[model samples]
Target chain A: MGKRVGIEVSIAIADAVKLARADVIAAYPITPQTHIVEHLSEIVANGELDAEFITVESEHAAMSCCCGSSAAGARTYTATSSQGLALMSEILYHPGPMRLPIVMTVANRALAAPISIWNDHQDIMAQRDIGWIQTFAENGQEAVDLTLHAFRVAEDRKVSLPMIVNIDGFTLSHVIEPIVIPDQEEVDAYLPAFKPRVRLDVKKPVTMGPVGIPEVYTEAKMAHNEAIKASKRVILQGWKEFAEIFGREYNPVETYRSEDAEVLLVTMGSISETAMSAVDAMRDKGASVGLVRIRLWRPFPGPEFRKAAGKASVLAVIDRCLPPGAVCGPVGAELRSLFYKMPGAPKIFSFVAGLGGRDVTVERFEEIVDKARAYAKKRPTELYEVIGVREI
Target chain B: MAQIDAIVGWKDLPFGCHVYEPGSTAKFRTGDWRSQRPVLDKEKCIKCGMCWVFCPDMCYSQTEEGYFEANMEYCKGCGICAHECPKDAITMVPEED
Candidate 1:
């Protein structure tokens, strides 16, 4: 195990990318996510990392450059936040179907309208169905670990799908933490050189992103859909291998003292750490409460999630994003539909919290559990409740 | 005549539906979608190559006699060549008649 050193999460993520030895870094700096690519650029300038860091004009251009370099058989890396991710949304859908295994870090932040730059799931949830493999980091170490894991799984020949590692903006990105920086030899053994399954070449050329006419459009989308769904296997295998090489092990759904709990608190991103502390507090008070932290977001980890939250009588689910005019937040709706008609299913109480970087403190978690328990007995008329919003 | 008539199902598509063969467009004849064909009048032809330079599909090429001829296989008959001809050397006519 390498020595754990104190470093900002963004810098740690950049070092992780360097350890992976990315061939190209194309990105437009955005708030919160800026430090990640900023460090990357400096590394390239100092000859510490032999990579081309293309400073693109806009997020759209950044993603466009990523597509081009990745298609030309280069291991690509980039980072973006809320609006930056929103801008890259258009071209973001390309890399997955094209099978260019580009790894990106998203400093999760709230979207604009009210113009707040803080940590939230709103940014990532907005682009939720972009067809890239997405995973959440509960803290700085997970942020660093997931960055390396993203590269490994994404570049797997059978699972050549782009991946996004979502780290909470100020919570994880800006915070300083003691993280074990793996040795260069260790990372090299863990993640080998990228070998593109199909790449653009002059001598023997292949036309990528050709016009998909009505004849083949449906079939083309189906193939991409199947490939991404199949990538779940490789995603799990990646963490397993990482544990063998490194000491830490990661899972799709992580549990905390929920073995015999009656109520479970569900959360994602960095706040999951807070939820764990709250679970410990609840257990001290003789409350049958546990916590479930979902690490894998895209493939949804249906089987593992069901196994973790199945025994609970109530699930106090927290979502940082509030999708306006919708029945419930994204995570809420997913669970509702997942357990919709199952026999003896747990009553799920969806609560949207921590919007615009408001802290989901341990106290707030206890409140969510109390509400979930109350609502379990008498269901609330509202589809989901947005907690911590002050009302007159 | 080279249009791809037989489209494969989902299971049979090449990975990402990528075309492995270079210049695979050569096998596709888009002319079938055209309603009109370009008629070149050699009598008025000055070989200025305006038609060759203006064709959207690059269908016009200079023949051995220094006259531009349209390769009917790929032309969609958009009439940019006929419209841009300096000497009125090219005109579009209904393909049916």
Candidate 2:
């Protein structure tokens, strides 16, 4: 059993990492992600956690340092958001193919040309294809649990791939909530010490990240693709172990009140909580609406999503990042393509909302559900609809 | 191509980006890229070791008698050693096909 205490989500995540007994933490301060590394630094400095906290010059350097440490057989972690994630983008691709189990926290925030430091999914969404196992946390507890889960899954020998846990920027990162702080014994029982399959050592040297010439480049990429897709088993195993120890169940795709509903609102990150309330309210008034929150984003969890969403007659996928000039937002576009050929798949209506720190309220979700229901009936040819757009 | 096939056939080579053995590139003979090769004039050589320090490919190795010679197996024949040799004891010559 674990003790429940009220703590800021970022602080809880830092504590979770400390409990996980990370060997190295390298990060640069970025809005919304600053508090996480700051807390971790204090934890290391105070001797509560015996770890190396590297204050890197930039997010690029932070990820580079993480790569070096993780390659040297250390359990490594880092946190970044928005431009920091974009800055680290160059090195992000290296960890996946190098097969280093680096755990990172992306306090999801909107990207910038104008530059606003508020909450959105744009930061993490832009990094979808980087080969990291991405998991979205709906709230503070999920933030802590998923952070620990990420380390467990990443370090699994079968997986040995990097992972990112996305917590919606100020919305979740800055919020204080009651969360279970698992006992060190329970955590130790759940997560074993990282045993690296390959590492950089002076005594037994090995090359990592070698240039793949034309002859083997395609084969290398194909192997990487297979590794990530195959990691789904290890991911589920991690979750199963976590549930056994903590008694808190988690799934790749979680649902609320969707068993018999004909209409479904699909969401990721913090907005799913708001969507849940909207579903409750609509159900009270005799509306057949439900909520599907995608927890695992990478390796896509396609089969789980198909099973969860197959029964619904109409599905409204609310995307937080606008995939500019595309027919739909990123999540919407993915869902559309996923279901395009599947027999008995629901009609997926794409909706873009809550971008750039905009609040997605229950009423807005209600409106989105109504719009999706209407669109299902009319069957419009448009790619997707941008919700809450101001009419001139 | 045969050498590449042999290296690629190594058990650990198939595991994507992993390098199972250290210094595996030593087996990859980059000397094949050479259009020009460096020849050492043992009689004129002063054994200053400047060529050893200046070779871009680190292909220059010391003989048992302390004279430096280019290990043509891995040398790309960049001529850096010949260019930097103070005694003009090393010369760059075109390789015969």
**TM-score per candidate:** 0.90, 0.89
Clashing residue pairs in candidate 2 (N, C-alpha, C atoms within 3 angstroms): none
Alpha-carbon shift of residue A33 in model 1 (angstroms): 1.4
Which tens-of-lDDT digit does each residue in A55-113 have in candidate 2? 98999999999999999999999999999999999999999878899999999999997
TM-score of candidate 2 to 2 decimals: 0.89
Which candidate's lDDT is highest? 1
lDDT of 2 at A38: 97
Model 1 whole-model lDDT (C-alpha atoms): 0.91
Alpha carbon lDDT of residue A85, candidate 2? 97
The C-alpha RMSD of each candidate to the native structure, in angstroms, is 3.1, 3.4
For each candidate, report its DockQ versus the true two-chain complex: 0.43, 0.34
Q: Indicate the docking level reached by candidate 2.
A: acceptable
lDDT of 2 by residue, B1-97 (tens): 3135334522245453777766666767667788898888998899999999988788888999999988878888888888888889888899983
Worst 10 residues of 1 chain A by lDDT: A210-219
Interface root mean square deviation per prediction: 3.1, 3.5
lDDT, candidate 1, A256-372, per-residue tens: 998989999989988988898899898999999998999999888999999988688888889999999999999999999889989888998899999998998999999899999
How many residue pairs of model 1 clash at the backbone?
0
